[model samples]
Target: MYTYSDFDRAFINARNAQFRAQVERRIDGSLTEDEFRPLRLMNGLYLQLHAYMLRVAIPYGTLSSDQMRGLAFIAEKFDKGYGHFTTRQNIQYNWPKLKDVPDILDELAKVQLHAIQTSGNTIRNVTADHFAGASADELEDPRPYAELIRQWSTDHPEFQFLGRKFKIAVSGSPTDRAVTKAHDIGLRMVKNDAGDVGFEVIVGGGLGRTPMEGKVIREFLPKGDLLPYLESVVAVYNLLGRRDNKYKARIKITVHENGLDKYRELVEAEFPHRRAAFNGIDQELLDQIRPQFKSPYFTTAPKAEFEKAYAKDPVFRSFVDTNTATHRNDDYAIVTISIKKHGATPGDATAEQMRVMADLAEEFGHNELRISHEQNVVLPHVHKAHLPAIFARLQQADLATANVGLASDIIACPGMDYCALATARSIPVAQELAERFDALKLEHEVGELKIKISGCINACGHHHVGHIGILGLDRAGVENYQVTLGGDGSENFAIGERAGPGFSYAEIVPAIERVIKAYLEEREDDAETFIETYRRVGMAPFKAALYPDADKGRKHAA
Candidate 1:
């Protein structure tokens, strides 16, 4: 909830004017596509299959109602009527025209939003736990540190161009909902033996062509040493990371090539000089910014009405049970407004829906919003007393899906439909799977299952961490799908194991159905979800279920 300082406002305004000029130059044929590519990418514009896509940063996934309304206005006035929320907690307009993007940035800057560093080989948007301050079990709010890092990283001259793009995520809760382990830099706030708060710094974790969990570079780093240590890590990576091969340019590759100990030693060697260079300016800024995150006023609203509604309304109960999370205050709850309606695109939210969320944030929530990496909009601080009415309002807007963390709550990237890198379709596969699970009425029965689908190996859909991951590929110029099992994205982070041969897009849905049926029949009890069952009895059973004809082929060979 930090408003822009005068310097911040001036800086963004100046950048926007420069970009507008660059856009004009490109449009006038003074610059070719090759020349304008880097220029547009720096401003978070991409040429997709049919049109230009604009990705706007939602720093740490935090937004005010006014900011949310700005996004709504952009969706309404500029591109299509809806926008796609991405895994990086950013929003993308898929059908934006190249000519209109600069205007969109101008509008965004009016609300303290921008598209800078959303693309390109620079430090990308800083992300944190959606429930950073409000989570009931969090050690401390991690957004202050995240904000500090954002201010330091954005437009830092030294890191403007690196071997590869870098991402940083912070998690305040023990549950690790932010998928910190899958980031270039992951910071988890923890209390030490003496109860002093600090960070557990992790480095070299990402999911792409090569998937690896981040390794702990430092067991405990005092809060004061955060920026200096981070600088050292990035500096080492910048020096040692590969640039010859674009595929291996990520810091994860750098960490993999150099052993963790060696990397730590290099970082330690540079830490002293970097630490001294800090000069406490970042800390001074952090001290000034921390006050902006004060908790909203809480009223002792009676919960009797919520209890009665939970008892009386099954639909409302279903929504509250599925979408609500425990809050720091007993009377407040964190509500996840799922954008994945059954059989719809996973992350697309209409302008009307965005406006509705803004209205709810203003009236019921603390006038703040968070976009979850799972592509859901979160009202992080809503009073329990307002649950029924909010649910009713959301229902009226077609925003009450009541399917958070369920089979129907799928995470998918825009595959062949929009992305040029995609080989197969992700949205259709996600749609089919979600619809199949809904038709079976087995999503809630399955219990706490995550299904992530990616169009390609880039892993934008986080298919690597899903309980049931479906990856689309182009095999022999045909669209084939691959499945992975037992992947997890929480505290127990693990890359999924592949099952077997790729299935046709048409066959993938039924294959997934077989896998689910196997889980339902083979699980010890309803207490065990798909992941638990897969862990207990490896991938053999699921593989067998997926390829039932394998037994006949073996029999014929015998």
Candidate 2:
């Protein structure tokens, strides 16, 4: 984990003081809601359905054990007993009081965490692969670069008020666990034929009303030129990006309207000018930042104990099988703590549970914790021998769910319940689906199914990438839900296809059941998972089961 320097400490302290005064003004009626809106948003405070929600940034999804404990403290002291981890790897407290937010931020600043850039049209938190430094397939750790980008974009003069919120994700591994292609900007770390590191820059990718896979703006940009190159891209977008309509304000729209070739030409023309202006300053800064992220030391311990635990404890074995990943080091493993317990709210962790995780990270694992893009927390470096003890501790805290890549592990957004932009509820739907599947114990039987839910067309829940995706919509003042199938979240990502007609809130769960049952019946064997079966058989059978009346209507229309 990266520690905050004196500079970071001073900056956060000053910002907190400013926000404290602003909050006092708002409470005293010196500032009305209209006047306080931007100020509150800049501080990552939002007025939600019932209360204010505070989103705190976990930079590149990485945190220290002490920071985790601080978050736990905030959750317990101020809001409800639990917090919701978002898809962007930030955590949101749904019930924060308007007046207490500054105090909460003050506590967060003590641990080098803050809510800056967690919301608004400014550059949002820069995300990277959760298993960045530890992943066996990684060419380099992407966090230092992500942190560099964060520093450059935070309160940037040129990009403070972009047309819309901008999201950027970086992945060092070829597997693309960060869902880079689904972001506004995706940077894939690559090694050239000469073995020099660089980035394959992809732009225009986003998921909202208009979902798009990013276009490759530059096939290969040397690592040294990354900052300058990124600056040029943003500058081009800032100058040319649509501002006339909110719907057309994103850079994706700019790329779509002007065409990729023309957009590339414009960006290329601007690059040289920006490159000359920076004059290798960004590279020098990166060189300085790189050493701060050097790999942690590992002990040469024997794995015989881990092997014995795997053989003896079925529960521990299951967790080890599903939740742990290979580390770059021999005796260490990356342990994923599953937030998706069956019948529990996906990504919701109680304060006590957070403390337990923090303790475990500090004790058995390195003091480093990671938040996955799937909204799960990870202990990035746990020795294999500590598996049994760690599992026991996590079980005590109710954090020992064995479903990692399974059906019950759904990714959902805080929909109508917490988000003002939402047209319908998403979290409840995800909960219902989890409960229904757990009752049937069909998760393991169905195998590796991803079900993502979004409240509206914004697709924050990533409904576009699920193997079985559900979208909540509003129809005639009633909440309705739609289903999409065969979506993938991998390197070979594809947006799902819609099943004919939408269903009411009550009908949606059964619709999902129908789709799953149909898959089990039509699949070649148990070996074929839902996604594979859906891909091989297409959406015909699932659609037929979901919308038989629609099929009949189509026939009648013909």
Candidate 3:
């Protein structure tokens, strides 16, 4: 994990002090709610439906044990007893009191964390693959570049306020776990024909009312040119993107209005200026950032104990099969601890659980913890020999659910529960779905399904790319849930297709069950996942299942 330098600490303290005064003025009636909105938003504070929410950025989803402990302390002392880990790999304190926010910021500053650029129209937290340095499949760790981008973008004078909020994600692996296609700027590291690794830069991808996969603006961008090229892209968008209408303000919409060729031309034209302005400072910063992300000292260990535990305990076996991913070191395994136990909120972690995770990371995970975009905590460098002990510790903490890629492991946003903009509830729907699937005991059978839920069309929950996407809306004063099928968020990214009419809240679970049952019956074999079946058979079967009486009504009318 990257530690803050003296310069970084000084900057954060100064920012915190400024915000503290701003918060005080708001409380003292010098700044009214309307007057203080933008100021608070700039610091990642939001006035939610009921109370204030503070979103703390976790850059590239990396954290140390001390940082994790700090978050746990914040959850315990300041806000409610829990914090929600978001799809962007940030943590949100939903019930934070406005008066206590400055104190919380101070506390976060002590741990070298902040809420800077977590909101507003400027670039948000620069995210990367959660398994960046640990994953065996990646070309190189993406976090150094991510950190470089973060340092460059934080409070950048030109980009402090854009037409709309922008998100950027980087993934070094061939497999795209970072949802690169659904970001404003998505960088996937790829090897050129010359066998040199660079970036496949995808721009204009976004999900909301209007969802579109990013277009490949550059097939291979030289690693050295990354910062300037990114600046050029953002500069072009800032100048040309719509400011008249907030709906069409995003870069994605800008790209849509203007052809990709024209946008690319503009970006290319701006690139030389940006390149000259940078003058190699970005590369120097990157060189400094690289050492901070070097691989931890790995130990050669016998896997006999891990094998014994797997063989002897079915529960442990299930956990190992589901929760662990292959690490670069053969002796190490990347362990994803499921915070989504049956009936729990998808991403809410209690203070105690946070502490437990921190302890585990400190003890067994090389003092590093990663927050996955899927809203789970990962011990990215856990040795296989420690599996049994780690599993035992997790079991004690009630954090040992073995459903990493299963149906129950859902991704849901804090919808109507906390968000003022939400039209309906997301957490309840997610809870119901997880509980229902767990009770049925069919998740393992269902296998590798992603069910994302959002309260509205903003797609904060990434419903557009879920295998079974659920969008909850208020339909003429009633809660109606819409479903989309065959969506994928991987390297072969595609937006899901809608499956006809929305279902009532009461009708949703059964409707989803029908879809699952239909899949089980129609799939060619057990090995064929829901997505594969959907792709092969199309929406006809799932549609038939969701709206069983549609054909009956049609026939009767005829």
Error of 2 at 188 (Å): 0.7
Task: Give the residue spans of candidate 3 off by over 4 A.
Answer: none
lDDT over C-alpha atoms for residue 484 of model 1: 91
Clashing pairs in 3: none
lDDT of each: 0.93, 0.89, 0.94
Q: Per-residue lDDT for 13 in model 2?
A: 93
Evaluated with lDDT, which candidate comes out highest?
3
Q: Write the per-residue lDDT of candidate 1 for residues 268-332, one digit (tens) a residue.
A: 99999998898888789899889988788887888999999999999999999999999999889
- Evaluated at residue 217, the lDDT of candidate 3 is 98
lDDT of 2: 0.89
Q: Which residue segments of model 1 deviate by more than 4 Å? A: 555-558
* Root mean square deviation (Cα) for candidate 2: 1.7
lDDT of 3 by residue, 1-558 (tens): 688999999999999999899999999999999999999999999888999999999999999999999999999999779999999999999998889999999999999999999999999999989999999999999999999999999999999989999999999999998999999999999999999999999999999999999999999999999999999999999999999999999999999999999999999999999999999999998888899988999988888999998999999999999999999998889999999999999999999999999999999999999999999999999999999999999999999999999998999999998899998899999999999999999999988898999999999999999999999999999999999998899998999999999999998989999999999999999899999999999999899999979978988999
* lDDT (Cα, 0-100) at 516 in candidate 1: 88
Candidate 2 residue pairs in backbone clash: none
Ranking by TM-score: 3, 1, 2
